[model samples]
Target: MWGLQPFYIPWYWYPCSTVFGSFFERWPLNKLELGMPRLGLLHTGIVLLLTLITELFLKQLGLDLFTTTTGPTFAAIWTTVGLGFVWQFNMWPFTELSQPTKGIVASIASLIISVFLYLVTVFLVGQENIIQGLYWWFNILWVQVFLMAPGLYDGISLWQDVPPLVEEQQPLSLNSEGR
Candidate 1:
């Protein structure tokens, strides 16, 4: 258990720095890729384990894991994983199914969904411990979003590989040419 209190220390700094820094800059961290299918799962396990450890650390620091407000935090994590497949495919927003857009939409959509779910969870659970719950939720989801970043980008990039929707040229008939 980490000795630091839940809100006493700057919790966001470590997770935020680790999350974004490792994600975009690829700075001070591991390169997790969906291409390595086996390794990807292993990496996911490692991340989830670390999250549990952090929560336990917070608990050791006297933070209650089951407080009503924290319920939404837990829900956000569940939401992230639930949306993983759709996010990776850039398949949200049914209206844009035919559009050739990048995976940026998926990431943004995922974030919005996560936030919405968190709020809903908090509303159902209670607002007293919402901050604590959000703290945990965001930390875990941050890593999830980071891990999914590559796959999501790949899905978007995959669109570029597709040929343009141009009109097909007709083949001339052999008989017509002879005639």
Candidate 2:
């Protein structure tokens, strides 16, 4: 199951291997925003196409369509998630993302949040047995590969526009009417 197929890999996903390309062109590792990804109509269509192509490729690679039983299929999802995070980090391997302590704290926090969200989504989707496993696969692979990538990029770009943090004073007490 670990064998790499000799077929040509998809062009779009390959750019993740490069440093500058991955940071600017691919999805950022941390998801900073908490709402709908700002994909326009044309971008949405492209992402859907890319996701379908990736799913088909995974199916071709012998991933189980029925995920009811716990086996290689479920294991693959965990493996991919780990690999994805590692790969994203590798994009800046020689450089520090931030101070070591801050980076470690952020990394640990992000991992916890990611795990909690996955469990929540699976429960909310009403997935059970094999379907739950499939949902994991879909979310780990296609969702990140396509949907999250574009959305994350938009978020990072938008973040630049946010005003800097400023300290403001607050009144001690107030009344409904004049006081």
Candidate 3:
């Protein structure tokens, strides 16, 4: 299942992007503004927490769930929902576009990107080795890096806007003052 590897990437990446990316994006807005350092830490913490919860949920569901046909279908649906609704809504909270228009655009964009990833993965690996396929597909590093991108952007933006610290004047010396 060469296709399975790409499916796995988006399956993990999109949801993290939608949920964490959306919330992290708001850190720059007035409603949820935080200092850059704090925002970075908070973003890391949130990602870790979400990853932990997801791992626990999957573990509870058992490995057999992923080995079944239902696994891929469920993953596809999950990724679609994240990209279509969650990512779009979070990415464009203050857009002037109409709701339906935004939704259609988001859905199409998400579908295209997802399909492209799937095709690329399938083409590169070509369904030769199942073990390698599983390893490549299930790698968590891709998901972590994807989720960190927005935070890194936010951090850089915040860093640039920060005012430089001014040096404090030293008190006059008693000798210099002729005490």
Candidate 2 residue runs with Cα over 4 Å from true position: 1-39, 64-90, 94-155, 167-179
Model 2 root mean square deviation, Cα atoms = 13.5
Write one digit per residue (lDDT tens) for candidate 3, span 1-179: 55663323234434544543533433333355677888668766665565455545554644222344323433443454433344334445434544445444654455455445444554666534434433554453346346634433341134566687987887677696645
Angstrom error of the Cα, residue 57, model 3: value is 1.3
Task: Work out the TM-score per prediction.
Answer: 0.31, 0.31, 0.33
Better of 2 and 3 by lDDT: 3
Model 3 C-alpha lDDT versus the unseen true structure: 0.46
Q: Compose the digit string of candidate 2's lDDT tens values, residues 1-179.
A: 46853332332232212212223332332333433455344344544454355446445544332232322333334334433543544323423454443334433443344445445545655435545654566567665566444433331244566787886866556786536
The clash number for model 3 is 0
What order do candidates take by lDDT, descending?
A: 1, 3, 2
How many residue pairs in model 2 have overlapping backbones? 2
> lDDT for each of the candidates?
0.47, 0.41, 0.46
